[model samples]
Target: MKRNNWLSLLEGKYRVEIISLCVIIVIWGLLADFVVKELYKLPGPISVFYAFYKVREVIPLDIAVSLLHFSMGLAAGAVVGITIGGLMGWFRVIDRAIDPLIEIVRAIPPIAWIPFAIMWLKLTHYSAGFIVFLGAVFPILVNTYAGFRGVDKVYIDAAKVLGCDKGKDLIKYVAIPHSIPYTAAGTRIAIGIGWMCVVAAEMLGASNAGLGYRLWSRFYLLHMMDRLVAYMIIIGLIALIMDRIFRYFVEGKILKWKKGTVAV
Candidate 1:
């Protein structure tokens, strides 16, 4: 009975959200059929669908550019941020010295760094990657720092008594597991920030590619409204997919020890 109740809650909550989405879709379809049909010929879902279906042919180059930058920037940010964060967290003096500068840099909006990125990297892929790094790095660093700091002292004490203070074994047996939640949270946040910065990062300089560049290009062209909307939807869906993947990986593995929510 207890197991059944938990299963029911998960299904119920998931179904409710799906139903809400369906309701919104139905409302949109109706509005498109009646009001929009009579009005200024705004392309509805059909147009959006068609645009998406045909997008590869319409803007292959631009799509490739956007994906390239997004992937590259995210990868770079994750590597650099985790390395720095782990180091700082593992060491007290280094954390104190670097933490202040990290905070200051993090406080500056990523978009504001566009000028510097462009100037430093000169309208290259690295510029976009740098922008993405700026957006994603802070969340990763902060989460790692928190997690490392939050590790129970008792575990460290035990590790010490067990003759575990020498080499790789110490970090593997002690520090890594203790900070899994922090690392997971930081990775989740970094993914979100990287996605959010995609458009702005791509917008940093002149080129004939990327979602942001394409949006600007299309606005100037004043054609293919549905294509623009399709791009927006695609970006949103990608983010959603990434978030779902993250949750599954984190909760199912890294955070399995956490108590599951109790259903009423």
Candidate 2:
């Protein structure tokens, strides 16, 4: 029975993932060994495995610093984006007046702000966080605004009929809940972009320590291919972990009501 259960488990999608991953690793190893032919240029999976051991001592600190930077920026972006986006969406005049400016600013890439961040914040963790903020804020703001704008007329009318006539009351009772999904989607997107920005922010010398700093300075610049690949893998893994956590809390718990409407 135990063997049968194990075979059944191996018949699931998890099995496919495991098989595909093994195939990919084999292909990567072959490419590194036959095509690259240089450890400094393209180290294989086995090489990256050993490299992880070398970085074990510093990996925790690097992860913490990167997370700190990401957290500061994500928190600030959520607050500012949601607040401004809410006001703009709730009031047409505010939207018209501020939207053009926002559009113009949004056209500028997050990397472009690196120079200003360095100058203004002066190469501290704050500067790194600021770059992350630039990456995260606009997606959240745009999505939140869309959510508020998309609140149905019928919902508003019904709320008003229920004696929730005040702007604050309508917003609190109807609009906020309606906008939660949009805001959640934007936050997920921002988390991805923000994580990417963390690497860029640290890579460009915005901070002295972090995954990006080590990935660039200690590995890439030093031509340590195995270590660099390890860092890249670590970054991807961390992002996946964070995304799962967000989905669990936001979609699984807070938005559990949506399960009926969604495929889940």
Candidate 3:
């Protein structure tokens, strides 16, 4: 019964996603492959896939390049983000003082900092990772801080009566568990931003290989259709994987007792 309920929850003609994908392919085939090729001249999805297959015969450099930069930026963001956010959320004075500075930078688009990234880190993966970091960091920080700050006062009061009165023990035993949901929510959002930044960063002369690099490189060579489709597929796949990872780990165990809501 539980399994059936779970399946019903998710099964909203989800298989239509494949149908929608094919419909798009057919539309592109007629317009781009048949009509557009007759004019400016370019290969379609089939030929592009064939090229991708041939390219794989040598080595898959692009995948590795993008993943490396993404991992670095994501790790840096996750570590620093959670720590600082948690601290700021925990301490009222610190939150009030530093929040304005965080907000100022947060308003700027991640790509706007590309020129500075190049000047500082040069045209390298570090620069690319910096862009991704900028994209990811704020969401994580905000979510974590919110989570940290939002812990129930009642829980704290109860803990105090239970001899968890010390500051360190209060935070360790009471606050941390209470804020897990917020932390997980923040993490989920941060990863989405990180993936978006990877493409922009890679295109800013930071990498020779990566989905972003390929998207730009392919377009200049008149492979617009392939570039468009590839990025769409890559970003979609990455989001899916990221969400699944968060759901499996965070949702399953992090706040099991507080799944529905926190009762007063």
In terms of lDDT, the best-performing candidate is: 2
Report the error of model 3 at residue 119, Å.
1.3
List model 1 lDDT by residue over 1-264, tens digit each: 457864576577488887787788778768887787832245577767787887766567776787787778778877887778877888899898998899889889998988888889887888887888888888887777776777688988898899887746666787777677777777787888887787877654533468877765763256677777788776787788888887887787667786331100
In candidate 3, stretches whose alpha carbon ends up further than 4 angstroms from where it belongs are: 1-20, 33-44, 57-59, 218-228, 258-264
Ordered from best to worst TM-score, the candidate numbers read 2, 3, 1
Q: In angstroms, give how far residue 105 of model 3 lies from its true place.
A: 1.0
Tell me how far the alpha carbon of residue 126 in candidate 2 is from the true structure, in angstroms, after superposition: 0.4
- Encode model 2's per-residue lDDT on 1-264: one tens digit a residue: 457876786688799887888899999999999998989878999999999998899999999999999999999999999999988889999999999999999999898888889899996889999989989999899999998999999999999999997999999999899888888888999999999999999998888899999999888988988999999999999999998888888877778877632113
- Compare candidates 1 and 2 on lDDT and give the better one: 2
- In angstroms, the error of model 1 at 191 is 0.6
Lowest-lDDT window of 10 residues in candidate 1? 255-264
TM-score per prediction, in order, is 0.81, 0.94, 0.82
Q: After superposition, how far is residue 221 of candidate 2 from its true place, in Å?
A: 1.4
Of candidate 3, the 10-residue stretch with the lowest lDDT total is: 51-60
> Which candidate should be chosen as best, given TM-score against the real structure?
2
- Whole-model lDDT for model 1 versus the true structure? 0.75
Over 173-262, each residue of candidate 3 has an lDDT whose tens digit, in order, gives 977777777777777777878888888777766666687787676654565655445455665787788778767777567667666432
